[model samples]
Target: MIYLNQAGYAPNSTKRATITGNNHYNLFSADGKKILSGECTLEFDENSGENAAVIDFSEVTEEGRYFFADEDNFRSPEFVISKNHYDQALRDSMKMFYFQRCGMELEEKYAGVYKRKACHCGGGYILGDRFQRRKMLGGWHDAGDYGRYVTAGAVALAHLLYGYEMFPGALTLNLNIPESGGSLPDILAECKYELDWILDMQDEDGGVHHKCTSASFCGFIMPDEDDLDMVITPVSSLATADFVAIMALASRIYHKFDEPYSNTLAAAARKSWTWLIKNPSFIFENPKEVTTGTYEDLCDADERFWAAAEMYRLDKNEDAMKVILGTMELHLSMHCLGWADVAGLGTLSIINSGTDFFGKDLYNRLVMKWLDEADRLKLISQSNAFGITLRPIEFTWGSNMVILMNAMILCVAHKLTGDDSYLKSAQYQLDYIFGRNAMDLSYVTGIGERAFKHPHLRPTAADNIDAPIPGFVSGGPNFRPCDEAANPDNMSDVPAMKRYADDVRSYSTNEITIYWNSPLVFVLGYMNSL
Candidate 1:
C-alpha cells in the first residue's frame, strides 16, 4: 500500500509517498504514459516499527493527473499536480463554518441537500435564574453536540481572523452564503455571525459566559429536533479573556468595512479587559447537575496573556502592555495554539503588530522563540516515517488539530524567514491529513478517495443523509480511546496512529468541532496563497 496526499499537490511543491517495501517505482499519467521513475529507499521507522520505502517525486512539476506504480502492481491513489489544487478544499473548509451556523435556517439553495431549519433560536434561561431568559442565539455549534462555547468560538475565530490578516487574497473567496456580496469578505462575514453570538455571551458585568448548553448532551438528532432546555452557564476568566482577545482582533479586522460595529467590539473588549483585571482567577467549573461539555482549564494565565497582547495591539494601552510583559516573565506555554493554551496567539499578535509595542528586544525574542518551536516541529516531521510531526505520546484526542496547528506555525515561519524548508514540512503535515497515514483514511468528510464519512456530529447522524456535510474535519486518532466504539476492549493491540474508528459512536476519535476546522482553514488558505 502506498500513502500519499490524495488531495493532490501544488505543481512546484514537495511530492513524496511512503510504501512498505523498497522498489523501483513509475509515475504514470492518467493515460498510459510514464511521467517519471524513481527508486524507493527503505528505512526503519522507529515510531511505527515498519520498514518504510519513501519515494520523492518532487521533480515532476507538470500539471496533470498521475499515480505511482511499483513492481508488484501496487498503484497509489490518483492525484493531480496543479497550482490551484487546493482552492476547492480551502473554499469547502471555510464554507463549513457557514453550514455550522446555529440560529439561521440553512436554505436548500445555499446548503444543497443538507439544509435544515434554524436551530436553538429560542432565548436561553440563565442556569440559576430559570425565569430570566435572554436571547442567546447564533454562533456555530461547538462540536458534535449542539452546545455553543465562548472559548472554543474565540480560538476558532482567531484562526480565521489571523489567516485573513496573513493571506487576505487567498481567503477572499465568495462562499455564496446569505451574507455573500457584502462589503466585507465572506470569510469576515461568516466570522461576524459567530462574533455577534460571542458578543451576546458577554454579561453586563463585562464577564463572558463560558457556554450556553443543555444540562446534558442531547441524543443524535437534528439541531431543531433536540428540544432540551438550553441554559447559559456562568462566566469564567477563561471565556472573558478569550472573548477580549478575539474581539480586539476582530475590531481591527472589521474596522475598514464597518467602523461603528468595530467600535462596538472594541468597547466590549475594553469592558471585558476591565473585568479580567478585577477578577484575576475565575476558572469555570461545570455547575452541579449541568453536565454539558466543560471546557475547564486549570490556568487562565495564557488566556489573560492573549487578551492583553490583543488589547495592546488594538490600542497601545499601558496596562495591557504591563500584563504582556508580566505574562512573558511568567514563561507561559508559548508554542501551543489550542484554546487551552493560547499564549501563542498572544505571541502572534505581538509579532504581527510590526511596531515594537513590547520593545525591539522582546519582539525579536518572541520571533526567535516562535521560529525555534517551528524548527523543532520541522525536525520531527523530518524524522517521522510519514513526514508528520506527531510523536507517539502526541496521539491524544483531537490530534489532527495538533498537526494543523504545527502546520500553521511552520507556514508563519516560512512567511517570516522565506524558507522553503518550513513550508515543505508544513506540506507534509497536510499530506498526513489528506491520506498519508497508517489508516490511509482522509480524516475530513467528503474529501480524498477514502475519506471518513461517519463523524460524531449530531446533524450528520440524524439528518438521514448518506453523506455527511463536507469539510467537517474529524478529531483524529486517539491512542487512549474514550468512546465505546473505540474503547480499549476493541483497540487493545492497535498501533497509536491506527487507533481510529470512522463510526458515529466513536466521539473520542471522530467528533468534529469548529475549532478543529479553523486551523485547517488557516493552513489551506496559506497553501492556496502559495
Candidate 2:
C-alpha cells in the first residue's frame, strides 16, 4: 500500500512526501492515466533508513481527483486537491469520542453507523476498601479495555478541550451527536458527555478515584457483555490534580453555553484543587487484586503544575499562579503530552490562558520558550526522511499519541507565530500517520485503502461489521511489542517505523484510545481550517 494524505491536500499547500525505495514514480489522473512522471530522489537517514519519495503537486492547481502510482505497487486511492479536503475527516474524528462514551446507550437516531448497547452502568467499589462503594457510571472506556481511568480520561478530555479552545472556528462542524444541534459546539457536547462521567467518578471529598475496572481485564466481548467484578479503586493526588485541571478548563468553556453546569464544574474544580493542595504527595499505587492499566505516576509535579495552572485560569488565585509560574521555570523543557506527564498541558494553559498573571514580560518569555521547543522538534522533523518528528528512541507504547501530539505542538506554534513551516510540518506529520510512513497504512480506521481494520477495541471485536469503527486512530508503531496480541515473528527485528502490525493481536500497535484519537481530531480540525 502506498500512503498519501488520506484527507487529501490543498493544491497550494506544501509538497506531498511518502517513503518508497524505488527510483521512479508517476502521478496519475483518477481514471488511471499517468499525468506526470518523475525520477524519485532517494533521501537516506542512518536512523530511519531510506527517506520516502517526495511529490511536488503544488503546480497542479486545478481542483480535481488524482492519485499516486509506481511500477512496483498497485494504484493509490483517489484523493482530491480541493479547499476542503479535511472537513469530513475532522467531523468523523470528533464523532469517535461519542462512540467511546460509556454508561450510555448509543441510540440509532444519533449514532448512525456506530450505535451499540449501553454499558458499565453498575457503580463500583474501592478494591481493598470494598466497603467504600462509590457511584461510577460515566466516562470513556480507556483503550481496548472496559475500564475508565481518571488520569487517562483527563488527558484526552483536556487535549480535546485545548483543540476546541485553540480552533473553535474550525471545530464547529456538526457531528450529529445526541446534542448535535444544541447551543454548545458538537465537540464540546461530546466532551461534556465524558465530563459528566468524570464528574461522577469524583468522591464527595473531591479526590478523584484512579480508575473503575474489574479485578482483571474482561474477555474480548462487548462492553455490555463484560460482567466481571467491576470496582472503583483508590484515589490519588495525581488523579485529583489531573481532574482539577480538566474540570477548571471545562468550567471556563462551559460557562458560555451552560452557566449552571459550568458553576458546578467550577465548584468541583476548587474542591479537587483544595484536596490536592492538602495532600500534595498522596501518590497512587494499584491495589494488589486489580490488574488493569495502572497509569501510575510516581511524581506529582506535572499534575500539580497542570492543576494549579488551570485553577489560575479559572479563579486566578495568586498563590496558584505563583506556584504554576515557579513550576514552569523549574521545568523549562517539555515532554510529549501523555497520561503520566502533563507539564506540557500546564505550559499550554499558561500560554493560551490570556492572563498575564506572571506579568507581560514573563508571559512573553514563556511563549518564546514554547516556540523554541517547537522549533527544535520542527528542525528534527524537517530533517527526517518522512518529515516525522519522532526518533527511533521515542517509539514506545502509544507512540501514535506522541506523534500526533508533536503535530499538535506544531499547530499551536503555527497559531502563535504565524510560521508556515510549523503548519507545513504538522501537515507532514498528518500525512505520515495516515499512510506516508514506512508501514504504508493509515493508522485511522476506515479512511485509507489499507487503513487499520483490526484494532484491540472491544466494540470492534464484538461488532458484526467487517471494519472497525471509523476515525479511531490506532496506537501506532511501538518498538517494544509487549501485548499478547503482538506477533513476535513479524515484529522482533523490524525497524522502528516499520514495527507496526495491522493485525488485531498487536495491541501495542493496534489498540484505539481516546488520547490517541483526540489529537487526531485536533490536527484534522486545524487542517480543515487551513
Candidate 3:
C-alpha cells in the first residue's frame, strides 16, 4: 500500500515462527520480479507454549503463504516495529521547526530609490540582517543595490521554507526573476532587466567591483565596510554571499513549487550557482566549504549546499546527492576541528540521509564538536568569542546564531543516538540564549538587559537569531555588544514585541530576520510534524 512518506524506518530484526502448515511468503512486483525465500519447514508452535500467549495459534494447521513486511509498514514480523519509531520521532520534531518561522516579519519595499518620505515611500517584503546594520545619522543607512539584491534573494528563501518549495525545504535552488511579471515577451523583458542591472554591475570576473553602491529600488547609499569588500574577493570565503543567495534561490524554489515549472527554474539556475561557487567568502576547500569566519556579517556558503540535498531528492537525480554528500563530507572533514558554527551548517542536509558515514555516527560527531566549541575557549570561533577575547561583543549575532543552530542539531542528534546528554546540551544552549535575550521575542528598541525592545526596526531575510546583524542600540551588533574602545558609543539593544503589545517580551530582538526565522521554523516544523 502507499503509506505516507513518514513511517518507513522499522525494527530490523524479527523472529519467524512456523505456522504448522504454511511457512511461505512471496513478494512480487507488477513488472514481474518475484522473490521466494525458498522453503524452510516450520519450527516453533504458537499453541499452548510460552510463545502461545504472545501469538494467536488458531490457524496453526494451515499450510499456505503468510504475511510480509516492508519499510514503513509491515504485516508479519512483530520484532521489526522499533526501526520505524525513529521516523515517527523525526516527524514529531516539526513542532519546534515550524514554530521557528513565526519570528520572521515582512518588510515593505519601494519600487524606486530616494523617496523623500521614507515612511510613506514604498513597502519592502522582508527584513534580514542585510538591512539591520547600515544605520546612518540622517536615515537608515543602506548598502544600496547590493542590499536590495540581498533582500530579493533572501525573501525567496523565507517563502521557500514557509512551504513554497517544490522539493523538501533543503536544496538551495533559485530562479532568475523575469524583468517584468507580465506576458511571455514581457517576462523575457523583465529577466533581461534584472540580469542587465545585476550582472552588468559585476566586474569582468563576476564580482561586485564597488563595495558600496546606490540602491535604485530603495533610494539609499550603502556604506563601504572592510569585510564587505573582503567578501566579493575571488580568493576569500564569505558567509554573507551565501546567506543572501538563499533569498533569490528560495524565491524561485517557492514559485516552482507553486507552479511545477521545472524547466524554467533549471534555465535560471546556472548564473546564480556560478555566483555562489565562485564567491570567495564561501570557503570550499577539499571540494567542500572549509574556511570559517564571522557568523553575523558574512553570508554562509553551505546554506545553499544544504538546500541542494533536498533538491536532489525531488529531482530524483540521485546523482545530485553525490554532489550534496561528497561536498558536504569534504566540508565536515575540513571543519570538524574548527569552532565556527558556519561549518556546521553544511551538516544540516546530511542529517536525514542514509549513507554509510552520514546515517548516524557523523551526525553525533558534529553535535559533539559544536558542544565542545560552545563549552570551551580555543574551540570557539572569533565571532562567538565575544565578551572576552576577540572584541567582546563582535559576533553577538554570530555567537547566538551558532548556539541556536547547534541546539537544534543537538536535539536531532539526541533522537538518532538515543542519548539524553545531547538533548541536555541543546537545552543548555537554548537556556544560554535566555540568559541574555530574556526568553522574549521583542528586542526592538525600548527593551533592555531585562527590558530590551526594538520593534520599530524592520525584519530582514535571514532570521536575526541565525544571521549576522550589526545589532540594536543596547551595545553590540558588529562583532561586539559593547565595543567600548572600538565603538565607545555603540551598543546592542533588545527589541520590543510589536505584534504582542500586551505580551511585551522583555527579551526579544528588534526585527525578525529571515535566516533566524528559518531555523526556528525548521526546528518547530521538524519537531511538530512528527
Rank by lDDT, descending? 1, 2, 3
Q: Can you write out model 3's per-residue Cα lDDT over 292-343, one digit (the tens) per residue?
A: 1112323343444443444443343454345455554554431221122233
Query: Which of 1 and 3 is ahead in lDDT?
Result: 1
TM-scores for all candidates? 0.98, 0.95, 0.39
Worst 10 residues of 2 by lDDT: 45-54
Q: Of the candidates numbered 2 and 3, which has the greater TM-score value?
A: 2
Candidate 1, pairs of clashing residues: none
| Tens digits of lDDT, candidate 1, 1-530 | 67889889888888988876656778899897998887767787754556786678889899999887888898888888888878777888899999899988999989999999998878798887999887888999989999999999999999999999988999999998998898989999999999999999898989998999988999998999878888899889999999999999999999999999999999999999999999986767879878888889989989999999998888888888888888888877786799899999998888887755668987898899999999999999998679989887789899999999999999999998999999999999899999888788888787788889999998899998899998989999987998888987888677788889999999999999999999999999988887
lDDT for model 3 comes to 0.30
How many clashes show up in model 3? Answer: 135
lDDT of each: 0.89, 0.80, 0.30
Candidate 1 residue runs with Cα over 4 Å from true position:
none
Q: Clashes in each model (backbone N, CA, C under 3 Å)?
A: 0, 3, 135
Q: Hey, what RMSD does candidate 3 come out at? A: 19.8
